[model samples]
Each structure stands twice: as structure tokens, then as C-alpha cells.
Target: MVTEKNNKGNQISRRSFLTGTATAAAGFMIVPRHVLGGKGYTAPSDKLRVAGIGVGGKGESDIAEFAKGPADITVLCDVHDSRAANSVKRFPKAKFYKDYREMLDKEHKNIDAVSVSTPDHSHAIQAMAAMQLGKHVYVQKPLTHDIYEARMLTEAAKKYKVVTQMGNQGASGDGVRQLMEWYNAGLIGDVKEVYCWTNRPVWPQGIPWPTTPAPVPSDLDWDLWLGTAPKKDYVNKLVPFNWRGWWDYGTGALGDMGCHIVEPPFRVLDLGYPESAEASVGSVYVDEFKQGYFPDSCPPSSHCILNFKGKKGKPDVKLHWMDGGIQPARPEELGPNERMGDGGNGAIFIGTKGKMMCGTYGISPTLLPTTRNKEVNVKQTIARVPEGHYVQWVNAAIAGYGKKEVSSPFEIAGPLTETLLMGNLAIRSYDVRKPKANGNGFDYPGRYIKLLWDGPNMKITNFDDANQFVKRTYREGWKLGS
Candidate 1:
């Protein structure tokens, strides 16, 4: 293995040295940037070289944010040229590629970090590739599409010893910290039940796949866009957006918003893997007599209950997750006119003493009765992210591993994402069908079943069929951690 010296003159393996050394040798004598000024100083040219995968939609905004820090946008890759046009115009000098794998193959040496904002299905493989090449990574929310992928990435982050951050920006916000302080001070007096709700699936859901296939767009590389997802024909309006409703490309409303909503309770309560999960989903009626259940698409609404064992002497906690315009009842202590959780998406904690609530991103924290919010005071226990979420990762990458602490490191984000996806497992299981006794129609076997979870083993103890979803089989040519 090739090795390089750090600021402390300690020899470290350079996994990408073969590719990177030639580029550096052609230019100038390559000196580790941290050694330039002093022990802790960063040089003027020591900007983090970044490559972005899926540079469209949220990917576009993520790269733009990274540019605001001490970083250089070195390369851009997107499956669709039209969606990437804005980012390409912004970074006119950056090299462009239609395939992320191709970009990583040739440009791994040129990049110190990678930003992944692709669809949920592709996040794990792309991030794994970057880590294998010894590159720091900043992945967007819902870290992976499946539980096994989340476990693999968490372990890989430690093995590779690289800086990692997940794009659940609220993890760095002050609101969650406030909730933590309040809980620590015994303000809410040990939360027993929690509620998180969102009005998502703002796009189409609870429907069938389009019967008519559309012509692939000239600017889009359909094959590359599919990535690790199973091969399928292109349908109109699936790109740019609306993929959130599909299982193959997306993980539905829970996957889309769970990270933001469930994160607060996870942090404040010190939660771990849920012991068991059960869900009841809303149905769409295709006709007056028949209710629709499409295996390919997510239900229009769902309510999942996840049970977690008590920690630090508190009683067991029950977490309720509701989506599709569903919400919890207003706290009796709250004033009738006062807003409850920003009117749409929010989280509420019910404790023995009182209740507390916050909106999406864990913003606008408040204690029940409205007056208590102003009356209660607690010292700030957690340090705030001064430069905000995007810059936190940028600075950490430049400082090297273990120097600066990031808010949503893979160690924490991975589990939180896994817990959220567990709710998805229950939602999908609720739709499982079998032949009816009378042979007239199908019976929903998974309904009303509380799937016992063996967290350490990553298996469903009660239901065997549900195990198939725990780890998805990638397309023949696409491999994870390749």
C-alpha cells in the first residue's frame, strides 16, 4: 500500500495515491496542506476538492451550499443534462459526467470529498464507492434505502476512517439542542409517548404505474439514472419528481420526511432500534365497492407505531408517525388559537409533567400551555454548529478525520435512518396479500401483525416474508461497495 505523511509526519495509507500522485507530480511538489502554517493552521489553497453526484433538484442546492464554504467544486455528475444545467452554469469550470461511477473511476484522485443527493435507492452504492476510494462523503437524508445498507455504511465509515455527514440539517440546529437541555433539566419529566406527523406525498401515490411507456428524453441517460434500481421502462413525469411514490426508486412519505421528524425524539430520548413495529395505512377506493392497494406504489396515508425500550430509568416509549395530512390532537394545555407544529409537519413529545413540540427541522420548539415556553429556562448543554450544516462537513474534511466533530456523522445518522426505514417495512408489510379462504379475493396477511424486530441481527423475528425487504438484491451489473 502507498503511504503519505500528515502534518505530524505520521505515515498514512493513501488509497487513491496511484491515481492522485501522477496529477500532483505533474503540477507541483505535493505537501500536506495542514503542515503549511503550523500544527492547526489551514493554508490559503487548502480548499476541499468536492465532486457531486446527482447534481439535480436537491443535489443542485446541496452543491451550491458546499460552494459557500472553503471548498472547490471539482466535478459534477448527473443522469440528466437538463436538470444539471443550472449547476453547470454556476460552476462553469468543473468537469461534467453523465455517470457517477465513471466520474469516480477517473476523478477519485481529483476529489477529497463527495456530495451525494441522488434518489434513495442509489445513496448507499454511491457513498460506498466514495468511501472505498478513501474520500470523505456528505450524503443526503434517509441515508440508505434498506436496513442492511445502513448497517454496512455505518461500519464502513469507521473502517475507512473518513469524515462523513448526513444531510438531515436539523441535527445541527439549536432547536434540538434546546429540547435536549429541557429534557435533561427534567422539564418534560421523561417522555413516554411521541408523535410525528407530515402532510407529504404532495405528489401522486396510491395509484398504478402508467400503462403507457414514454420515450426517454434526449438529455437524460435513462440507464444511468436507474443505477441500482431494477430495470424498468421509463414513464412520463417520473423524473425531476414523483419517484417518491414508487418502491423501486423511492421509499415513500416516511422515507422522505421521517429523518426530519423522528430525529428530535431520537436525540432527546437517546433512542435505539425499535423493539417492534406495527402500522395501519389509509386506502384509496378505485370503485364504490373495492378499496385499492397497489404493491408498486405507497399508500396515500399511514400511521406507524414503533416501541423502544426505556433508557436511563424512564419507562418504555411509544412513537407514533403519521403522514398524508394526518396530525395528532391538540394538547389540552395549548391555547386553541396557537399553532400546533407549524400547521403541517411537526413533532410532539408527551411526558409525565408536560408536553413539548417543534416543527419540521426541529425548529420553533415550545412547551405546552404556551406560557411555560417563556417561563422555563435551561442552560445550553450542546454546542451549536456555528458555520451551519454544510460548512460543518466542509471544515471537517479539510481538518482530516477525528479533528472536528460533525453533527450527523454516519454513526448516528445511519441508525436514525434505519429506524425510520423500519416504519417503512411495516407499511409495506401491511400491503402483503394472500389467497382468500373463499377464493374470491386476496387477504392481507401482514395487516394487524406487530413485526418483532431483532435489531442486532437485523431480522423480523415474527414474520419471515418481511425479511426479504431487509436487504434488497441489486441489479446484476450494479454492486454495492464495489
Candidate 2:
């Protein structure tokens, strides 16, 4: 029974199977699905079995969308019980676990795909583990905590041949395609500068951590939530959302919204690594006379500039990222009362001939002068993702590895995440203060320096200290790929 008959309907001997001559001499062993059920007919067992990690907040929505496709939510994992409460009710049949590690280990064979919606710090390790198990993964935006982790996960997705997508849902939106189409048609005339801004860090930033530690919530697993982050006492109001302002747990404004706002320009410009990066961060005034840096937290505001070498025959491009309510001045072409960049989070491209802008998720794309939007007609060259981002991954996972294309696969999202994190590197470097030689005060060593970057090497050639942020040393027992 181990050996089956081949295409000519001839029975294949064990010798033929061992010699790998089944295709040549005896023909194929496994029957094609079309032969059994006709074309395009999927069996019940063909439904992709999916697991959701950190199934709360955005995770809740992500899993629900996947459930709409040919997918079955088989498991859910979260560090906090309350966060998982709603998702558990939504998927009554799905098993729930507190630790993703245990769930993956126990149900590896049963699970076909994983959706990682954890915080920035834990994203890499969780996604890598699933990919290593040959499970397709859909990770949340800003794919990883550090540049090295992003690079590693990008390579792992390819090596494992698993379908992968980042939760930058905007990547799948039609707006970006329109932007690309317009750019290709030379409507923007070789963009030389891009401005992306967001009013984020809506949580606390540029402030000290609570001096008094608060007791961990009864329903939350503090240790598991910390994951690879350095051990620290629990602080009230830090969990769930406030962690976005902390360097150890989150990546500030850039990580929170850059992936969505900056993605269009990155795609349209075909930008890779930045040649150099520099930044200026706004400081918090503790009092009328005192200003503080609060190195542990992200600054209240920042303006980072990254220079990218030109592609093809275009000129070099300079990208400006502003966050924490800072925004670029209105372009002259826009009407006086008209809004810029959705009034809060948006992206604007400045080219030799014209300008174009869009809001978050690359939605609401418009050209300068407003009237050009209606007048300029461009053919859509890029294909749109059907049913949008979540379903895009759902269908791709069911299609198996390399069978379907995903919009933000790790290969593309990784470098994009790295590009955004580079702005953070510059921001963090801006806070690097050292004792002065005169001993009178401290000097900010990292300020005003244009840090040269070597993308392939993932290092700052001019600043050795800045390289430390490129990859962090995990807490002893917690390693990426463990």
C-alpha cells in the first residue's frame, strides 16, 4: 500500500519509489485535487488552522477578519486574561493559552498559521519561532523591535518558505497603488523630498518612569508580557497602551504610525537604506528653569531627516519625519483653509513639477492645487489586494508557501521597519550625553552629528555607540529564535 500506481495507471515497485523514478518511470503517486473533486473545489479540511497571539486590541480585529476567509481560528494566546476575554467569546471553540511558547509547542502540528499582535519588543521572537516551525505569520506593524531582528525575520521567512505578511494594512489599500501609479506616470516629476508627520505618543513621553512601583494586575502575566525586555518594576498605566512612549517596550511615534504614513513614499520612491540620519528632539521642561531629557522615554517631539541615494536617473531624496504634533508648513499650492496630511497624520511628497499628499493608511490621495486631482488621469498599474489586508494574508496562507503573493511580506516590511527605526536610532542618539572633559557639566555627544550608515552591515560607521541600538541583548533566557 506504501507504493501507489503512477500516471499511466501502472503499479510502481518499491525499487522505483526508492530510486525516485516514480515521475519518470511510474508517474506521480499523489492524486491532484482536480482529479478527485474537479477544479477550484476546496475540501473542508483545506481550511487553514490559525492561531492568534496577543489576541486583544488590534489583535481582536485581525483575528476576526481572518475568520471571514477560509481559515479556522484554532487557538488564542495573551499575557493578560482581561485582554483575551472578548476574543475568547468570539472564538468559543478556539483553545486559549497564556504563553505563546507553550501553545506553539503543543499545537505546532495542528496549527498552520500564526498572527502576532504583541508589543514591539516581543514581535521578533514570537514571529521567528512560528516561522521556524514552518508556520505562516502575519505580524503587526513595525515588524520588530530592532533593526537586526527585522533583518533576521526577513531572511527567516524566505529560508523557511512560509507565507508572511506584516499588519501594515495600508500596504494593501488601493490608495498606495494609486500613488504608485501616479508616480510612475511622472505626475510628481521625480520626488526629491518627502514629509511624513503624526500626532502620536498620545501616551506619556519625555517624562520619568513612576518612582513607586505598582502591583501587577491580577489577570496579567507580567513576566510573559515583558518577554525579551529588561526586567523592571511594574508601573501603573504603563500596560495596554502607555508602553508606546518607552524605549524598552515601544518605539515611540515613528513605530506607532510611521509604517502607515511613510509607506507610500517609500514604495513610490523605491527607497532603500538611508545614507545618513540626523535629528533634533524636543525636550520637556520640568519647571520654568529646568529642562530634562528623560532618556528612558521618547521625546515629546522630534524631527528626523534621512538622506537616501537616488534610484535610476532620479536625484537624491531627503525624507523628513515629524512626530508628537509637529507638522510641516502648508504647501503653497494648497488653499489657505485646506488641511494638510489629514490634519494630524499624513504624508506629502515634494517633486520638481508638483506635490501629492495622502492621509494615514495611504488613504485620500490628492495632488497640489486640488484641481489637478480631478484633471490628472493616470492608468492604474499595480494590482489591488482583494478584500484588503487581513483577507489578503488569509487567502495567501491557505494557498500555501509561494503560491500566492502577499502585500507586506517580511522581505519588504523588514527593510521598511528598519528605515523607520533608523529615525529612532537618531532620536535616541540625540539623548546620548557624556561627562565633559572639563567636569563642569555633561556634553550631548550624539547631538548634531550626521551618523553614517552601512545598511548591509547594519552599523553606524561614524558612531560606534549608535550601533548598540541596532540589536539589543535579550534577557538571559529569552533569545530571538529560541
Candidate 3:
């Protein structure tokens, strides 16, 4: 995407921009300032004109945070007017549209960046479209609904040459940096095991889909809301929030919390793709005696183990992820009264020398034996993001791609997202059912199997059926393309 604009009133045509330019080849804006203007700017567009695609709830606050910096939210788009109301009211000068496609077509020339905070399903398409227009992008956590989309976005960021950041604010927090410093200092020596957990799925899960369809909200464009997911009737509680349980839209708990919780350990260890993944999920019963299959929704809880390759001579590392209220065993070093992971969500790193932990958003980092948090005075070797996640992206966009660094750019977030989603892939694979030849019962071959991964190729080497979850087919009308 285009980052820096030309000064001194240099002009370029749409054809020149859509095609290519020598500067674009070198990570500069192909479209000059004269070709894109509005909102009271001169030859050099000093202010970043950001257009929000999902300007509701989290989105409303996302754009609001952007506006706190040198950005003008030029357009607000949401499928539901009721949902977009707060943002619309907040930015009265910004134009409002229900369809992002129309907003982009009409407002592309005016927008310098895009912040996409839509559901997991639409994230790929909205962010892809914006990137294609040479606009910088700040996409929300988990990056995309599927591994394939995350991989695509990672490559697209480099291909488009835009400043990009995934919405994992914790990646910029001081707590994570402290953890990194401690690890680097060998306070946590040769970390071989990591545990991250969350109490998510505050929305329903491991349940059947709502059989009766609810009337679509009058102000909501239901079709647009569904985006890339297969056509389904609108149901109550799916809008505004509570879509986390369903596979067709949300990616369950792992996708929702993994990026925020896993980022700390991932960055500290400088980890990459997992070599293998496996899961043991909480099962739901049909009544009291029989276990039933509900592939439509995610399991209520799960424990996933993702094995990663260690450095040349070191032993492998195992990262454990637990959600739906499941947590790892408390460290023996801590007293019984001490809270584990801020009571519900937290991460723990176990190394050869010592252990360390942190709460959600990587906040309140602590060393085990609790008192050591103060006794061990590790120097702050890593730089902290004073501007935080949102402003960091804005400044980077202003500085242009490759000029400034972002904490969770697609290059980093893509593999991180894929790693977390591998757990979900195992969970989904665990539910795949096949009938027995005798026709007496069914066999779930996917269960109790370790999925070997070829991360570079984005495939499940051991389970072909499980590979289906790696990518998804969009609904007829939507497309995630260049």
C-alpha cells in the first residue's frame, strides 16, 4: 500500500497508480498527493485519512483511538445502522455507508489507511480490498478466520508495500517487553514449555445452532453482514456480539483470545510455526448418556498442545493453550493463596532456570516465587512503545512502510495466527464423523490423532480431512482477492 505522498504538488493518473511506478517499486506511494486529496490538506497529505469498515462496538473505539492521533476518519461503514450509530454520531463530518464496497469505490481516493474491525469472516476481504487500493491497514486480532487468509495477508502486505498491524495491542504493552527482557537475561533460561489460557466463549458454544430464525434488524443489511460465510438466516444475539460460538462466522475462543494472550511468549521466544498440533476438547452429550455431534459450533472447552521445533541443538518446545475455563496446574513454587493468571486469563513460561507469568494483555508480569519480581532487577533492554498499539500504527503509516516498525505487523502476526488456529483445526478435526461399515455406530478417526504440520506449505501433513479448515470457500458474492 501507498505510504508517503509526493510534495510540491506532484500529480499522477489513476492508470499510473493502478498499474505501477518506479517509486512504488521502492516502497513509495505510486499515487501522488495531487491525485488524492480532500479534508483540507495540501500537496503532502499531512493527516492520515483512515476509513473504518466495521465502525461499531470495538470498531467505534478503534477509529476513535486513531482520531486521537493525526488521522481523520473519512468514512464509516457497517452492515447495521444501529451498530454504526455511535461512530456516526462521533464523527459527524465523516460519510456513512452500509456497504464497504460502495464506501471504498467512492472514498478510496480520500482514504490513506483502513482499520478493519469486522467479524473473523469478513476481515480478509475488507482488509484485502483496502490493501489492493494501496492503503495502509490495521486489522483486528487473529487477523483472519482461516490460516490461508492469514498467509495471504502476510504476503500481500509485502507485495503491496504498506504499513500493516494486527490488532493485538498487548504486543506493544510494557509487560510483554519486560518478559522479553527477563528471558533475554536468562531469568527464564532456555524456555521449553509455555502455557496460555483464557476464559472466553462468554458467548454460547458446543451447542446446536438456533433452529428458528429471528427477523433481521430493520437497519441491518443482513447479506452484507454475513459477507463471506455461507448464507444463513439471521438469528437473535448474533449481532452486536455473541457470534463467537458458531464456526460459520466467528472462530470460537482460540481465535478470539489467542493473539492477545499468546503474543507475549511468541515474541519473547522468537518462535515460528508449530511442527505439530493436537487437541482434547470437552464433549457435549445429547442427553445424559449419549454424546452428540455438533460441528456447527465450537466445543465448550479445549486443551491444545502445539509442538514447535527448537534451535539446532536444543530440545523442542511445547506451547499449551487452554480455554473455556481450563487452566494448567499451578506451579508448586507458589503458595495456594496466590492467584493463577489473574484468576481466569494468563500465560506462564517454564524454563530451565526459572518460571515467569503474566495476565491478560500481558499485564502484571510476575516471576514465580512472587517476591523475585522485585529481587531480580533486569535492565530494560527492549524499547517500549510509548504511543501504544494504535498510535504506533498511525505513526508508522505516516512514516511510510519499512520506514518505521510496528509491533504486530502481518509478517509477525500471520504465523502467530496460524499457530493458534492450528489448535482450532485440531478441534474441528476431532469432530469429523464417519459411519462404520457394520452401520452400528460411527467412528471419529480424527480424534486422538496428532496433526503433523508443514507450516511453510500451510498443510496438515498427517490428516488430509483436517486440512479443510486451513482455508474456506467464500459465499457467492464475496471474494478475497488482489
Candidate 4:
């Protein structure tokens, strides 16, 4: 019953509240004067001096990358025994820790940077601590589990004067850079609406209610896995990867893939935040076995529609997100014969003049215009979309590369993440309201609710009740900046 509406009945309006203080906000720290020019200075280049937390699964890849060539990996941490073992094998000299705080404290002087590849919920706490210690950070996406945390991390990166990078590696891709060029150059004209869709059931779609007590793996540290989250008995249903679909630990398909799929549009358009968000989910199978996957929770298998209106930019732009293994109907722009892959987990920007198409990862993006419509030839973007994911980050970390700056810095990324997270809220509200998965609950299939964001206050004016979920209460020791 509780929604965004305030007790005073004042509604929130979505507006541009950022100070355009991107550079000032980040306070980009250059190599110190002594390190840069003084004769007595010694560079900390014996290796970049790296440490990693959550070193398993995706975290393993992060560790390996930081350990390549000229880096001294002095610290490795993971709650899981097997994952930590494999990482230790790769960098035998590195000290290992089950608690990241201990590793950071003991190895503080030896480490210059840290890579965070933890679950969605824990990103803010770990990243903030590293930044507070004057360490540069590289973290995985969706940057934080909620809008409030994303903003906090961005601000902390600024206040601490540390270089920060989110782990949406596709934002570093050449294809996405070129796609942004095309969109910005008006090759697609003034784009008003974009459809970012994907087919991502690989983590097991359509759950039919999980049963109790499958043996917990010895390798997994169940207590730590539930770090900062509510405690519950360990169950087999949420392990390996399927935790994503449930509301307790994950954000369903959109939360899982939006960072990758939405990167191109967010950067090219300079999107701030959305005016409204709503959803129509497929089905929610309830069971006692499933509790606490997605915090502030929502049902699984949903189609959500998010609408963005301009408070300072152009006009309103609508983004339709289809997942839970669903694909968008083929765009009319494509010839009837020319078809795309069925796993339609990509974005289509329907601009005023033409349309731009991009794959899920965004690098292998392409341009497609209707044969009947006028065609415009524009200069290709020279950002040089990378050939692969790891290479881009590795090159950046090595050469300290590029003149233009990384594509998805928290400035551009933070807003995009805010928009994507709205889908999570929509799902939660839908479950509370008990809306039909199809359009049956309201007059329309997707109902829209306007929200106003006060960037300075970090409050949502229109939705007072929803603001409670905007920032979650972190468990005692796991609090951010502690």
C-alpha cells in the first residue's frame, strides 16, 4: 500500500539536480608532485601493488588481470576456501584473507589499488573502505544494489580523490563508442525512445518453488555469502548462479544485464534519471524455500517499462526492458528476411531519422536503417572499440591509456545505474499491489509513477514510502565507511 507519495501529498518531480561538477566531484589525483617532478621521488612501480576482495567466480578473473605482467598482487581475499585456493595458486606470494577488512589493514602500505568483484549488495561497503584508505578502485556492476548507494559511492570517489572504475567492461568497447558517435552525430537524429531487451535465462528461468536443505558445499562460506544480508538456512536453490532470478540476493534479469546493455545509450545521451517506472511480470512462484535473494524484494519473470522525461535536456524518452527470457518483436527497420539472434538481449535506439542497433556487450554494434527511409553517411567514431573485454581494462591499467577518458566513469554510469534500479522498485511494488503479470491490473499494462529526485538531499519527493527502501540498513560490522 505504501508508495512514493509523501505524507504531505507533495509529489516529486524528476529533474537535473547534478552540479555538472563531474571533474570537480572526482578531484582526479595526479601523480604527486614529488613523484612527478622532484628529483628525490621514487615511483611505486615495482608492480602496481594490487589487492583483491571476493576472489572467486568473476572475482577470479579480476585477480588474474591485476596480477598480469608488472603488478605485485600482495593480497587476496574470499570467503570461499576453494576460490581463495585457486587465486592463491595463481599468485603464490599474495597473503589471503577471509575478512577483507583485515587484509586491507595489514597490507595497507603495500597496496595502491583494489578490485571488488563481490555480490551486488556488498559493493558499496568494500569500495568505500578502499577509497577512504586512498586506494584506487575497480568494482563490478550493477555498481550498487540501489540508487542511493550508487550516488554514495560516486561521491566518496570524489571526496577521497581516488580513481574509480565500474566493472561494466563493455563500456570500454569500440563498438559501443562508435554507436555513441553515431547517435550523437544525429546519424539517428534526435532519438526519443530506446528499447534495450535481452534473453537471459542461462541462470535457469521460471522457478517452480525450491525445496529445503540440499547440502551446502564445503567450498562456500555460507555465513559470509550472506554478508550484510538477513540470515537464513543455506539452501541449494540459490547457489552457483540462480540467485540472480530471486529477489533476495539478485535483481532478476534486468538487474543482472542492464549495466552491459544500457551503457551505450546512457553515455551518448547523457541521461540523468528517469521520470517514472512500472512493470508487468510473468509469474512469481512463492515458497518458504525462497526468501532474501533480492533485498526489498520483488517477484521473478517480469517485463518492465521505464519512462524518462526531460527536466533539462530534450523531450521525454521511453526505454522498454524485456527479459525473463523474453525478446522484443523484431524491429520493423530490419528487412523481413534479415533476422537477429533469438536471444534478443540488446538495445535498439529509435531516433528521429534512423535506428542504431547494438549487441548485449555493445562492442559488436551495427547500424541498420530501413530501406525506405533516407540514409545518412557520417564520419565513423575513432574511440577504437576494443576487440575483447579483459584487453581493454588491462591496456588501461598498463599504459594508463587514452586522451578521451574511460567511457563509463561514475558520472555517466551512476545515472544509468539509477534508472536500471528503478525496475527493481517496480517489481517490488507490483508484488505488493498484486498486479496482473499482463496489463490487467490497471487500464494500461504498465502503470507509470512520477518521481522527483533531490540530488543534494538524496531524497525522493514523490515517493515517501519508497525512499525507505532506497537506502537499506547495513548489518552491524558490514557498514560502509566503518
The lDDT values for all models are 0.84, 0.83, 0.82, 0.64
- Native-referenced Cα lDDT, model 4: 0.64
Candidate 2 per-residue C-alpha lDDT over 350-465 given as tens digits, one digit per residue, 9 for 90 to 100:
99989999999999999998999879877554557667788877776665565566777887898899999998888887334564444322344565799899999999998777
In model 2, what are the clashing residue pairs, if there are any?
A: none
Q: Where is model 4 more than 4 Å wrong at Cα?
A: 1-44, 204-211, 284-298, 311-313, 370-377, 385-404, 430-460
Model 1, range 1-482, lDDT digits (tens) per residue?
Answer: 11112222322121101111222235565466545633223333589889999888899999999999999999999989999999999999999998888899999767888999999999999999999888899999899999999999999988887889999999888888778777777788879999999999798888878889999999998898898888999999998788889989898899999899899988788788999999998888877767777777888999999999986477999999999998999889888889999888999999999899999989999989789977887766456777888998897777666666677888889889889888888888733456444433334555579989999899998887778789999988999986
Residue 382 of candidate 1: its Cα lDDT? 51
In order of lDDT, best first, we have 1, 2, 3, 4
When summed lDDT is taken over every stretch of 10 residues in candidate 3, the lowest stretch is 11-20
Which tens-of-lDDT digit does each residue in 22-135 have in candidate 4? 222266554543456321121433346678888888988876865554566778888878867778898898888888888888987777778888878778788888878877
TM-score of each: 0.90, 0.90, 0.90, 0.79
Measured by TM-score, how close is model 1 to the native structure?
Answer: 0.90
Q: For candidate 1, which ten residues in a row score worst on lDDT? A: 12-21
lDDT string for model 3 (395-481, tens) is 777767666667788888888899888888888884345654443234455658988999999998888988889998888877887
Off by over 4 Å in 2: 1-45, 430-443
TM-score of 3: 0.90
